[model samples]
Target chain A: MERLILRVTTKLLFAPIILFALYVQFHGDYGPGGGFQAGVIFAVAFILHAFCYGLDETKKAVPQKALTVAMVIGLLFYVGTGVATMLLGANLLGYDSIDPDSTHHAGQHYGILLVEWGVGMCVASTMMTIFYHFTGREPDINQEDW
Target chain B: MSAFEVELTPIVFLDLSLLTMLILVAFAMLRSRHLFAVVMLSGIYSLLSAAFFVSLDAVDVAFTEAAVGAGVSTVLMLAGMLLTARREKPKTPGRAPVALAVVFVTGAALAYATIDMPAFGDPDAPANSYVGQQYVDETPNDIAVPNIVTAVLASYRGFDTMGETMVIFTAGVAVMLLLGLGSARGGREVSDAEPEDGEAK
Candidate 1:
């Protein structure tokens, strides 16, 4: 747990993983990666931090309030985008009404980006929350028994 | 040789290789007594299956499988394992045969059902017709996305993905409700004195 290599590696890898997750989230229209994968990748960075530094430390970095907020806001954002389009006189989630500009294509682009961001946020937070729950538990026995 | 034949040969070979590795990993997973080994084998099986998806040109699916299957799920499984016993109980002989028979019958039935399906990469296949053709042709004009899959998933099938996002949200809420996520309000306290597993119920 006190190894310098793992500690340094996790610290170094965290930012890059988040950056890649963002890239995947935004670039889904052009590539193989998307929100779900990006979200998991983002969660992996946090999980790696937990593994190297311990759960309590990670929990301190990402508190309970923030985790819950992230999870809720992500879904809300996705649904909110859809509702905004509905308010603009299009069907629910129809991207055409999202932009005031004449071209619907640009609206679609922006709409997809927003939704993917929502997905990425939800997934990353959910994964991290699950990891927190699993690691948060106190083992019935000693750590070495496993 | 024709272009199709040249491409098909290597893909078929790769598929067979990946499938072989998949089977081997599944067997190893079944045979392993150590739970850690089983988890690792399952991760390997996911990687092999992801490779198979790649050979089929389902890059998005392969990306998901590699990330969620081999990456997140494996870590979650290990974390779950840490909360429980490391070694599985030996299967009783009485229950083993019935399980094997059930598995065998199910596998045989599924394999038989595959016979009615169209051949792989058949352009005229039902899956490649109608909706699939429409998505491919219409996505560029309608959504203007380079990746049709993204266009369809994010726009054409937006409602479905909204449902999926909700499902994930529900899962997070459920985990919080069950395990408390190290929170004290409307959840169990995380102090050392309380029984950890008891909080779940």
Candidate 2:
């Protein structure tokens, strides 16, 4: 865990991986990726960090509070969008009133982006939460076993 | 040309090649006695299937499989395998034939069912006959997102995707309940002296 190579490589790769995850998330409307893929990719970056650094250090960096909040907020954001549409006198998740204009795609492009964002946030953090739980009990792994 | 001769399209050749690779990886996974080798082979199988998904024009699914399947699940499996035995013990020899017979019959039944299903992209197919037609025709004017899959998943069927997100949320909650993370930040868990596995296990 204290090796120079892994630390350096992880440091180099972490930012780019996060950046790519964001690209996959936001660009989902026009391209192949969406929340699920982006979320996993995002979690993988931090998991890579955990691999290089200790889990305790990774937890300190991300903090348990932020992770749980993100996990909760993601679902809330998705449901909130539907509730907003309903409040606007449209059906649940209907795109028409979201934009309030006849043209401009009924705000669907933005709608997709927001929903995907919620999904990405939830997925990424939930995956991290799972990782934390499963590997929280992993201090027993010897340095050689790794 | 002989009547038996068949020329496959390039896409078909790619799909067949990927399927062959998938089968080989699956067999390798099954036959491998080492748990580590089996986990690694499963990752390879996932990557092969991701490629197969791309060949079928499902890039989103391919991305998901490559990330969650080949990447995340592989790491998770390795972590899980560390807690268990390193090698798989052989089962009783007598059950092998019966197991093989059951597998063969199940596989045959599944294949037979596929034969009665509609061919790829048949316009009159049951799937294409329903709301799929309306979505395909109106998606451009309705949602305007080029990715119809996203448009459908996030917009037209938003309720379903909300459920998916809720599923992920519930998974986090369940894991938290079982494993106990984040709830007791200040009250308990003050001891760093004890290793996690000793107490947890």
Candidate 3:
């Protein structure tokens, strides 16, 4: 796991992985990607880091508290959009009133974007949280057991 | 001959080949005794299915299958295997006949059930005819999104997506509760999980 080749490859690949995840997240509107796919892809970059550099190193970079907060924030972001729309006199998640006088298209676009971003945030952190917890466990079997 | 013929178009050939490979991988997974190999085979299964989904023109589902199913799940399973035995424990053969019978009955029942369903992608099929058509027709004007799936998922059915997000959040929380996030190095949970030597007694 500590081979020089693996370490160098991970370092080179990490930023691009995150960049691709972001592309899948925002570019989803015009394409086949979406929040769920983007979130999982984003989580993957961190998982790759943990795989090469060891779990402790990755944890130091992304604190468990930060992931927890991110998980909550993403959910709240989605709900907050709905609340804002509601207060704006639109029904829950109803985007018509978001752009009252003009064409309702812009309203729908913005509403979809807002909610999708929230979903992406929640999914990414939740996945990272799962990966962290799973890998943090003490091994039950020794090398000889394998 | 006419009744037995299926036009072997390139798309049909590609589909048959993919399905054959998928079935082969599944059989390999079933026969493998090594847990690690089985996990790797399962990842292969996911990748094959992702390819199949792309062939079916469901790119978003293919993306998810490739990412979560093949990538993260494989890593997670390997981590899980680290906590358990590398080799699968020998299963007792006493129930093999009953299990085989049950599987055969279930497969036959499912195959029979599909006989009454409309042909694949039929224009008049209930699913293709109703709200699905409306969504496709009205998305440009109503939701104003190019990707109808995105428009429908994020807006037309926003509540459902919120619920799905909450479900993912809940799963993360449940994992944290069961296996606290290694915060303080799982100081208390580690003690609780210590190997019990005399539990059988």
Best prediction by DockQ: 3
Candidate 2 segments exceeding 4 Å error:
A138-146, B1-7, B96-98, B119-130, B181-201
Task: Report residue B87 deviation for candidate 2 (angstroms).
Answer: 2.3
Best by lDDT: 1
- Decide which is better by lDDT, 2 or 3: 3
**Candidate 2 C-alpha lDDT tens digits along B1-201:** 112323477888888899999999988887889999999999999999999999888898998999999999998888777666688888656557888999999999999999677765456777777888889888898888888999889988899999999998999888878867445364366556756775764
Scoring each candidate complex against the real one, what DockQ results? Answer: 0.67, 0.57, 0.68
Report lDDT (CA) for all predictions: 0.88, 0.86, 0.87
Local lDDT at B142 for model 2:
80
Q: Model 3 reaches what TM-score against the true structure? A: 0.90
Chain B TM-score per candidate, please.
0.84, 0.80, 0.84
Steric clash pairs (candidate 2): none
Q: What local lDDT does model 2 show for residue A117?
A: 92
The candidates, ranked best first by lDDT, are 1, 3, 2
Encode model 3's per-residue lDDT on B135-186: one tens digit a residue: 9899888887788889889999999999999999999999888878447354
**What is the lDDT, from 0 to 100, of the residue B30 in candidate 1?**
82
TM-score on B-chain, cand. 2: 0.80
- Kindly provide the TM-score of model 2 when superposed on the true structure, using C-alpha atoms: 0.87
* Predicted candidate 1 versus true structure: per-residue lDDT over A43-99, tens digit per residue: 999999999888889888998679889999999989999999999999999987877
Q: What is the TM-score of chain A alone in each candidate?
A: 0.91, 0.90, 0.92
